[model samples]
Target: MKTIKILLSFALTATLFTSCYTEVVVDDFAYVDEPTISLNQLLRSHELWYVDINSTLGYGETPFLQKAFTVSFINGVVYANNNIAGLGANGDGFGIDVGEYNAYENILDVYHDIDGFSTFDVYEIDYNTIELYNPNNDTSYFLDGYQRNNFDYDFVFYDNIHYFLQEYEAWEKTYTSEYGAINEFDNENYLQFLAGGNDSTFRSSQDDTGINANNLYWDYTGVYGVGDVYGDAYLKTLTLDYDYLGNEYFELSVINDGKIELFHPSSETVYEFEGRGYIQYLKSESGTKKEKVQSDKLRKQRKDKVANPRENTRKV
Candidate 1:
């Protein structure tokens, strides 16, 4: 009787642990749409440009920049361009990649040359439109409706000299993830860039979500390009370094005015952030300039260290 009771208890404990673990997966997106057979011919003539992305599984919000990804079908080869200017050109940034793609009835196969992997089951909506979505799966991902781009727009890349965070910019996590991201702690986080420094505050924090009102800083110079989200979208990438949070590469979209966006970009992992607030932008001169007071203070510190060997230390 004792042995049976112990066995049952062990089995129940094992089941509880098994149910709690969430498996991590890659944010690999494939397109799925349904249209007529003539859609194949339509794809060969024009390019499919990434326009917008909506999170049905996460926040259900649309990204700010809509004209980033470009895909053109030529002969049997699929040409890819990202953050390329002038309606997806032929040289440099445009058509930098050559891959293969095929269609069999409603299903399309895309072979990415960079990844060296061919993805299956992504559908296209006829020939002129492509919606990368999976509505039937329990956990789904999508990129919506790549349109034909003809207008002349210059591509932009992220650079620190031109695109670093402004001192007064206050941005909350506007992007709540899909795939059921766990807060696991109390759920509020906010950050502000201030006067050559970064400050963060967390309200009602959680234990394991890595939420703390600790030190915050930039990891490296940011990057902005006609980068790929589903196919190839454009956004500014900022990798954040924090005392408690470790590192996070935030996908940012700069809309008009102070409006912007943040994306976590992992299919299996989730970050909880939502709601309204404006992002403050710094002028070109103000962002890059340093204050006289700060410079003088730093000089004094170095002077103090050199002035007093016993108070500080002299190595070598």
Candidate 2:
């Protein structure tokens, strides 16, 4: 009887072990049906849409649109400011403002205008999902200089400038300078002074030591975004370091008005500011629109002069 009981116990343990070791098989061929309404269809059904930029930045007061032109699905064309029909020929081009990095729950709102009827909705789309649409519709024109190579099928379109403007304003706030030094000098003069200075006191403090007692060093870091509208200008973390007492300090300084908070990593003290005077000064000193136009015309003339010989040779 004891031997029979031992055999039964071993059988039970073996059964438990086999049950524990059972494998779970997932069917890799399982398929899901595509949604009945394509992103384009949804846009055609809605009239007006706006993306919430505030949703991207953890805390902001506005939203931006993915495209800032009136989209005509029937004609398959996009217009900038509703002026000059052709793409790149006479139009301002499509404006897209992607929001900040921290807002994980943010979405792009697309609006559609149908037969004098307008409706809007927000869709959650990301970088990877936007790669499916064909922007190369024969009748469509992308105003922005950068050509779109990848298309995503799931993107919704919106034709609202007001919505885009609101978001642009918010984004502009991020690039403005927030700090400035009271005493600043021109780059050339400052460099010459530093290089030719005979002051033993200044030299003693800053010469070989990493720690300079007479120099006030300021270091700042900021975050930015990236997209086509602001070609090559994507969101980035920027750092600016300057030695206030050095003449070369002004040349190395950077200014922006965007909401910024400065912290002393050693002491953990934070300083926040809304604007910088240095940037304002530089903007004022830059040439006016008329001067810029003249400069551009001259540059084109020079290029044409250089290319004329090549064209003549080709004709021959």
Candidate 3:
């Protein structure tokens, strides 16, 4: 009888071990229809960009249309930014956001920190492609196939101009005219280029009270967004846009960094105000610390090296 009992106990123990092993197997192979992605692991190394809106709910002026999107995951948290022109309904679509995510039961729950936003679900993630349904979206996917940006810099020339202006309240112009008329400039008594949003702001000096000539502040106004172009000019020279009369104009070959060399030649607009002079936005040393400098210098060096080629081959 004792021997029989021992055999039964051994059989029961073996069965229990088999059951535990079966549970682990089921855990890994639990979801069959969709791939089981370890969400935390995948998000750490990869990011997503919007390929296009999903074509399920029919398309006509959807929010994600023609808009850029980038989603990043860091330390179990998510951050996103949209470059939509008029961001979301009532300006809700623009700006940066921090959010959280949880993957459970074959679903991804995204919780945005912005108000008037609802928790969204990600139903499927296929390789680099993703399927999501935003409450704002008429169909699944606020965007699809969000890929990584290995060189993730959303910076444009306009952004650079904005930051440079925001850093300094007043600026000085030291320029050389084509005829050597406006070459001599003083740092203390500088031109009044009051930096305002969306246009060429009124001109003012350090002692200028209002946007006028009480302290030699001219009426150099800019009707912004109408003539602002941010791109490279011919021969890789970065340019800025200025307006004259009812026509649009681009100040080509204007060297604009922290210190600007305003050498664009046009007798009508502000380009010829000093006839090819340099303008420097004066700021506290701490303020202009991070501004990118000497890019034009590097550009010149490359041009010179090409123009006057040199070879370093010694006594061979």
Using TM-score as the measure, name the better of candidate 2 and candidate 3: 3
lDDT of 2: 0.23
The sequence of per-residue lDDT tens digits that candidate 2 reaches over residues 135-191 is 111111111111222211112111211121111111111221334432221111100
Over 47-99, each residue of candidate 3 has an lDDT whose tens digit, in order, gives 54442432333222222221224455566455443332211221122223345
- TM-score per candidate, chains pooled: 0.31, 0.19, 0.39
TM-score, prediction 3: 0.39
Error of 2 at 230 (Å): 26
Better of 1 and 2 by TM-score: 1
* Alpha-carbon lDDT, every model: 0.36, 0.23, 0.36
Greater-lDDT candidate between 1 and 2: 1
Most accurate candidate by TM-score: 3
State in Å the error of residue 93, model 2: 20
What local lDDT score does residue 268 receive in model 3, on the 0 to 100 scale?
Answer: 25
Least well predicted 10-residue stretch by lDDT in candidate 2: 293-302
What lDDT tens digits, residue by residue, belong to model 1 across residues 1-316? 9999999999999887766643211212212233334535655545444332232232221111111244555565655433221223433324433456776553445564433434323435444445433222221223333433542333422322122233223334444555545532114344443322221221222222233324333222322222234543455554544436555555666553234555555433434332222221111133232122211110001011111111111122
Model 2 / residue 138 / CA error / Å: 9.3
lDDT of 1 at 115: 32
